[model samples]
Target: MNFCKGKLRKLKQAFKIIYRQKSELAPTGLNDDLQADVMRRIRRLGPLKSGSNFLMLFEQFVWRLAPVAMTITLFFAIVLMNFDLIPDSEIFQLLYHESDDFSMIQFLRF
Candidate 1:
């Protein structure tokens, strides 16, 4: 534990030093104006393909959200099916009671 703490402190100090160096290296007012002038010389030739962009964005969104959706479904299914996991009390049972359309009966069929 002591070794871990010491190492963490050293890491924090190193990060502080690196952050100071990065801030020092950041462009000042005159340099930023000069860089903006340089960027103005670049030219845009063509527009992006909208169909491919929409497809790629939709796929990426699904890939990121699928796991979260599956996890939520699994959690609800487990909680709905396994009633005994809850304490044998009236209020708790009422709070977690399943709706008719999505009850434990429907879950057990699967």
Candidate 2:
């Protein structure tokens, strides 16, 4: 729509005005040294934390996390071992237990 196009054009013009660079020997205004100040502040901090630092942090915590993970896994294994995971109890009983009902066997045959 024309309205959207107008808004987009206005946004583009605003961005261009905000980010437009100028090469000059003299300072622009009183805040001319603001960029220098920001750079100095950033340089004061030695280095950014990289992925290797993150891995070392994770390695430090891994020993503490291992016991909890093992506990959960063992608990899950115990629960699964306690129950018959079959869908139908009737089929489970027929397969595992001896039954004396001739009618049920006939029905299964049918």
Candidate 3:
């Protein structure tokens, strides 16, 4: 029992030392640099602080426009896929007439 306890204590101490080493090796300055950069960019862009009414209107506009844009994109994609399914004139002739040559009727359709 004493031997087992000693082994557990050694493992715990080793884990603690390893954790401390890793923590020390990490870049401590990175957090401060990241925070400063973010703040600087925000300052350059200027705040959106045109009173509460502007924020409310902007939020409503985003909510309304998002769905409309998505729906328009979906419709265009559907139409494009349909046109793509209609084979080229050469391939269409083969399927329609089971012949390699293009007929007068097919030319008239074009």
Candidate 4:
């Protein structure tokens, strides 16, 4: 029984030494440094663009090319509008196609 009490006392002392309370901890500068490092990383990486896939890249491309696409569409509409619809007296011109080559027509359509 005395040996058991001695072993129990030693185990209690070991537990006390191993599991000290937070208030018993000595101050170290590591916490401040870790906080500063975290803040710096956050500041450096402010806003992240999620363009990691084909659809995301295509969406970004569409947004960037919207103005150009609109301008080209407007230009084509204007050109087609400006072209005289009525057939002239002297010469006849095809509105859309002016080529015999099938590949050229396909390319133009594309």
Sort by lDDT, best first.
3, 2, 1, 4
Name the 10 consecutive residues with the lowest summed lDDT in model 2: 21-30
> What residue pairs clash in candidate 3, if any at all?
none
> Residues 1-110, candidate 3, lDDT per residue (tens digit)?
45698899999999999999999987777587799999999898776766667889999999999999999999999989887554577666675787557665775586
Candidate 1 C-alpha error for residue 2, in Å: 74
lDDT of predicted model 4 = 0.71
lDDT of 1 by residue, 17-76 (tens): 999999898765568767777666542423457657999999999999999999999999
lDDT of 2 by residue, 1-110 (tens): 45698899999998877666433545666574887888888888757788569888899799889999999999999999997664557665765665564445654674
Q: What is the C-alpha lDDT of each candidate?
A: 0.73, 0.74, 0.82, 0.71
Model 1: residues with Cα > 4 Å off, grouped in runs: 1-48, 83-110
Instruction: State which candidate, 1 or 3, has the greater lDDT.
Output: 3
Clashes of each: 0, 0, 0, 0
Over the stretch 4-72, how does candidate 4's per-residue lDDT look in tens digits? 888999999988887786546867556877999998998887755543466788989999999999999
lDDT: worst 10-residue window of model 4: 87-96
**Which regions in candidate 3 have their CA more than 4 angstroms from the true location?**
1-50, 85-110
TM-score per prediction, in order, is 0.32, 0.34, 0.31, 0.31
Q: Which is the winner by TM-score between candidate 1 and candidate 3?
A: 1
lDDT at position 5, candidate 1: 81
